[model samples]
Target: MKKFWLSLLSIIIPASAVTFEDNDTVVLLGNTVIERAQKYGYLETAINLSARKKKLKFRNLGWSGDTVFGHARSYFGPPKEGFDRLKSDLTELKPNVVIVCYGAVAAYDGQKGLTEFLAGYETLLSMIQSSASPREIVIVSPPPAESLGAPMPDMREHNKRLALYSKAVGKLAQKHKLQFADFFTTLGESKGLTDNGLHFTPEGYQTAAPKLVEALGLSVATGNQLQSEHARKLREATVAKNKLFFFRWRPANETYLRLFRKHEQGNNLKELPMFDPLIADAEKQIEALKKTTLSLK
Candidate 1:
C-alpha cells in the first residue's frame, strides 16, 4: 500500500512537475513552514533556476504558528477573519499559482483532532481555490520534525500523527486533481536537515525545495552554477529583490497594523506601502542583471 501511494505521488506531482509558464505569479502560503522559506531563499532560488526563458515573480504570505484555518494570520481575531484577510491579500496579489503548506501545528492535538482537521482542511482548500479562481494549486504536507539526538520533544508520537495528516493531504490532492508534494516523507525523520528538529536549516530547505521542483517537472540549478561575473551580480540582485518583496508581503509588528491592536497604530500602515518602490527598484536591477540564462539541468 505504501509503495503504491509513493508511486502514485510520483506520477501526479514530482514526476510530472508543473511547467511554469511565462509571467506566472507563484504564491507561497501557510504557516512558519512557508514563512521561514523567505529567509533561506532556497525555495525561491530553486524556482527561479527552473525558469527556462521567462522571469517569474514570487510572493510569500506565510505567517508563523498558523494552522489550517489561518490561525496565525487571524492575529487575535477569529480564524475566519484571517481567512478573509488571506482572501483580500490574494485578491491584491493575483497569483496564478499557489503553494500551500499546513497541518503540522494542528497535529499538536494528536489523534483527537483528526476529524476536525480533515473537515477544516477541506474548507480551507475550497477557500483557496475560490480566492484564486482557475489557478493551479499545489499542496505540501508538513515535514515531520526530526526526533534524533539532542532534540527532545518525544516527537515520535508527533510523527505518527503527522503521518496520518500527510496521508490525508495526499488523498485530498488526488481527489481535487491537484499536485501534491509530500515533504513529510522526503525530509521527515532525517537528521542534519533541521536545527531544532521542528524547523529546517538552510541546507534542509535547499534539499526539500528540490522535491517541489521535481514535482513541477522542473530541474534544479544554483546561483553558483551560473559561472560569470554578471551571474553573481544577478544572484545578489535577485536576493535583494526578494528581501524587499518580503517586507512588502509580510511586514513586522502586525500587532499594531493588521492585528488585534491595529486600531492603535493603523496610521502606521502607510509605511507598508513604501516598500513597493524599493521592491520595484530591486526588481529592475534584477532584470538588468539577467544578461545570461541559467543552465538549468
Candidate 2:
C-alpha cells in the first residue's frame, strides 16, 4: 500500500522534470531554514555545482522566523508592510525562479493552522507570479523536526503535524503547476541533524544540501567535489555576495532611513545603492571560483 501511494505521488507531483536556464536568477524565500543556509552556503553551493554549466544568480531572501504573512520581515511596521517588502524585493530581483520553503513555522499551530497556512501560501504564490512573473516557482516542504532526547522535547507528534502541512503543500503545488520538493519525507527525522530539534547545524546543512538539489530534479555533485577547496572558495564567495545583498535590501536602521524616522536620516538612504557594485564584484568572484571547480571536476 505504501509503495502504491508513493507511485501515485510520482505521477501526480512530477518532482523530477524541471530544469533551469542560463543566466537565471534564483531566489530562496522562507524562514530560518532558508535564512541560515546563506551562512553555510551549502544549499547555494550545491545548486551552483549542479548547474555549473549555467550562469545562475542566487538571492537568499529568507528571514528568520518568517511566515507566509511575512511577519518576521515587518520589523517595526505592521504585517502588511512585510508583505509589501516581499513583493518589492521580488519585483526588484526579477527572479527567473523562486524556491519557497515555508510550513515549519505555520505547522506549529497544528490542525487549526492548516487552512490558513494553505490560504496564505496560495496568496503568496499569486503575489510572486504577479510581482516577478518568474519563469518557474518551486515550493519546498519543511523537513521533519528532530528529537535529541533528554531535556529536549520529542517532536514525534510535531512531525506528524508537519507531515500534514507537507502534503498540503504538495497539493497546492499541483494545483498551481509549480514544482514541489518534499524534504519532509525525503529527509526524514535524523539524530544530530539539528541543534534544537529545529534549526540545522553546519554539518546538517551540508548533508541536506544535495538532498535538496536532488529533490529539485537537478544533478548532484559528488561528495568529494562538493567538499573540495575550490568548492569551499566558491561557497565563501557566495556567502559574501549574499551578505551584501542582504544589507542592500534590508539595511540597518531601516526605520530611520526609510521608515517613520526617515525625516532624520533619509538622505543616507542614497548609500544603499552603493552595495550593488560590491555585490556584482562578489558574483564575479563566485563565477570564477565555479569555473575553477568545474575545471578540476
Tens digits of per-residue lDDT for model 2, 201-283: 99999889988888888888876678799998899899889899989988888889988899999999999999999998999
- TM-scores for candidates 1 onward, in order: 0.83, 0.94
Q: Each candidate's lDDT (Cα)? A: 0.73, 0.87
Model 2: weakest 10-residue lDDT segment is 1-10
Question: At residue 278, what lDDT does model 2 achieve?
Answer: 98
Those runs of model 1 whose alpha carbons end farther than 4 Å from true positions after fitting are 1-15, 222-239, 253-268, 287-297
Model 1, 183-286: lDDT tens per residue? 77765345677777788787787677766666555776554554456555665676677788877766778778876788899898889889988887876666
Q: Which stretches of candidate 2 lie over 4 Å from their true place?
A: 1-14
Best by TM-score: 2
Scored by lDDT, the top model is 2
| Candidate 1 weakest lDDT stretch, 10 residues | 7-16
